[model samples]
Target: MIVITALLIVVVLTLAIYLFYHHQCRLREMAFLMGEAVRNGDFTFRMPRKRMFFGERALLKTLNDMENNIGRLTAQNEVESWEKLTRVLTHEINNATTPILSICQSYLASPSIKSSPYREGIEAIHDTTSSLNIFVDSYRKMTQIQKPDPVELNLLDFVSGVACMYPSVQWHIDISSAQTLFIDTNLLRQAFINIVKNAIEAGARNIGVRWNRQLCISNDGAPIAPENARNIFVPFFTTKSHGSGIGLPLSRQVLMMQGYDLSLAQMPQIGFHVTFIVSSTCGSC
Candidate 1:
């Protein structure tokens, strides 16, 4: 009777183990299906809610909420970006056109001024048209970023190469040998150049590149005002006298396309900081 009781206990344990394994397999299958749906842009397709263990139920709910959040955020960002772009473009075009119109009307209204004196108005129109062309070309460049072709790179080499481009400024590099990342070399180089130039223009005496968990480029320059910092990422928003203001915004767009993030921060210590976020779970980044 004791042996029979022992055998019965063993049988019960085996049955429980098999049930747990089956449940795990189901979970994995569900996860895969959910992933596929998300990849295919089927946000409306949701997993069936059913009575399950607390852990599994909670996990599924979390995933559902994530899908909804992502969808909302993506839509909101697109709308905001386009709205900002439109505002900047309209303002720039009006600035260019208004001057040209006023100058031309004045030139035409004065028939006696059709002599060589009118040549000044013609020159003004030419200058304004040239400036407008330049603005349009810059806008095109901002909107039409080429698809990035990424390659693995050593952090030290990449940062050093960019720093070397600006020999006039002092550079402080602190990166580990093991710190490597994958990025589009050409595109990232452009972004880095823009930031370096911006720092130099901001009167930075020394620039520092450091790699802890994420990459940070800092400059010993005056901190940006709270108001300016808020609009720093907006296209055509610049405090510089001659700044076209597309540099930072375009750099950010390029980085975002490559599944990375860039942002400006003012550290308590001193100087302006730009953070490059590299996510561990972002396989493409």
Candidate 2:
């Protein structure tokens, strides 16, 4: 009887070990598939949950949830990216062509164009078109910027410079400490400009800029609606009719490329807040 009991215990232990190993193998396979899916940008595939194992089923559900979220975000990002490209193309083309067309019309209207003065106007048109082509090409390349050329910057001075561009909006600048930041000056400036423009567009009377551990730009404007808040970072999603919806997304993208984070947060008794997460050590100096 003792030998039989001992044999039964051994069988149970062996079965448990086998089951654990099998479960681990399944997990390993799932992890591999997930990695492949991420690399291939295929988020539609899902692993079947193990009904008998509650823990395994929970993990599968969590993974599936993550997959769905990633898929949705990816789709939105792609749509927004395309829309941003379109807006830039349209704006730049119009900017380049408008002046050229105006010049041509003026030349055509003047009786002097029929004389010996037509060559200069034609030359001007050629130069303008050439510049336009160059700008469009450069703009296209700018969209694919993978990284930023960082330089040390005085935080307050940089923010102040961007704020100076919009004189109509009242600016309140605060610095907890004199912090020098390492960032891409041009890219970060453009990002700041976008944020400030958004504040001005939102009918902000007073815009506040502060730097401590991070940079916080707040405006006393109408708060974003709940639904709009969720998609505020989405590319090409705009509240304004003429809004290309590119400003916030582009700013976010630039910051992200520079290893920074930008977000909209609410402050009690205050208005809309846009925060930029920078280096912590830089905050003290």
Candidate 3:
């Protein structure tokens, strides 16, 4: 009986030791996966939750949530980075182009040009430079966004006014008079206009808008291709033939300066093909 009791105790200890090592190995593998994913800039992974101990499961959930938030942070950082690059480029272009434009004007005004066969060539240069200036001015809008002047504003009235602008399209507004925001009215209006204009340009004849803390604008126009959605916020990138390519980029810059963000999200609705959500990056509202 004594020998049998010792044998049973030995078996229990061995099993416990083996199970503990297995658990440690499982946790270490999960940690390695998380580290590798973050290092590779891939935040779309979720660690398996099955067979995990209570504390281990909690850790897994937290890591998954952190990955989501990290992805959002990365996106915001990219937006700011592009905005800074655009500002520097636009400033440099303006500095270089202004002097060239002035030189062209001086040449055009000189008396020698009247009889010179080079008059036509000089005029061509003037025309080309003028057009370039105009184009750059439009691109500069992305850089010269105004600082937000927040005010107590009504959402219902504001959206109703915008809906009036597109009298042809049917607008479904789900906002209320009580739903208000402390924001720069004009700046937000400009941003909202660009969003709606893009929907209209996409052939959306019907539009719907709903707001709680964030704004969701949906349209039945063509759905954005999965491959193209990621590049929508990129400056000067557009799929449209006549697109100036600055509308969405400028809207994003305006909202970014105002502590907000615009994203193409897969929102739930049966009829709408695409939804652009305007949310606060600061999590204030």
Candidate 4:
């Protein structure tokens, strides 16, 4: 009886040791998975809520803090980039406008400016002035982007209003489903308007806008040349001669403020496409 009791005690001690090590192994695995998610630029991953050992809990908290810091840094970088671009664009625009305005004034002051050649020159000046005004307008819009007061809105209705505003542009919208989303209606309208305007300037005759419940996965899958794609959301990067380059960046900023994201896809057969992903919790807001 004494021998049996001693063997039982030994077995219990071995089992307890095994269980403790196993628990530690699980915690290490969880930590590794969380680290991988962070490395992949996914700051939204959440740790499991189950109670963990004190050390494990501390490690999880550290990771969460790291993610938040990274997010804040990334946002600051974007804002700084915008400020730099705005300064450069403003300087260029002022230089161009000053020369054009001076020339127009000189032409207008001349008493003998009634000839056909002079009239053509005046028209040229007018055209340059118009272009300068547009450039200044774009710069103003970028510098003054404001936060939107969000409200629940029908996606279809909102899109319809925008399409109506631009009768000359052909919009092919494929949103047949009735989805209501909470968004800053005015800001969203401005964003879509900018996107459609860019497409038009890109020589696109037909613009297609589609929405799906699975937009998150679709957003990640869009194909773009990695080089051009990285800076698509950066301010003041444009392919157009007169583009202020703030439209897409501002659009992204608006969406991001509301816990959303935007991505670009290049369809070689169909040109470039942009996708917006609204988070689940922020869906109604």
Model 1, range 1-285, lDDT digits (tens) per residue?
A: 999999999999999999989987887888898787667544433455585787777777777767655643553475357546766785688676777767666775676766667667676776777677566766767656799999997889898888778898898888997788788888888878888888788788888888766677788766677667657767778998888887887776777677665555334224434432332223222
The digit string of per-residue lDDT tens for model 3 on 1-285 reads 999999999999999999999988988988898788777555545589899889888888877777767765876677678778878887888888888889889998999987899989988988898888788788767767777899988988999999999998999999977988778999999989998999998999999999866788899888888678778878888999989877887787777676677777644355799888877665222
Q: Give candidate 4 regions above 4 Å deviation.
A: 1-69, 80-92, 112-130, 154-181, 192-222, 239-244, 256-275, 280-285
* Model 3: colliding residue pairs: none
Q: Which residue pairs collide, candidate 1?
A: none
- Per-candidate TM equals 0.60, 0.49, 0.74, 0.53
The number of the candidate with the highest TM-score is: 3
The TM-score obtained by model 1 is 0.60
Judge candidate 4 against the unseen true structure and give its global Cα lDDT, from 0 to 1.
0.64
- Give the alpha carbon lDDT tens digit for every residue of 7-125 in model 2: 99999999999999988898898889888876656554568885438887887887777875675566456545765766677577978687886777666667777575676767678
> lDDT of all predictions, in order shown?
0.70, 0.69, 0.81, 0.64
Better of 1 and 3 by TM-score: 3
TM-score of 4: 0.53
Which consecutive 10 residues in model 2 have the weakest lDDT in total? 276-285
Worst 10 residues of 4 by lDDT: 214-223
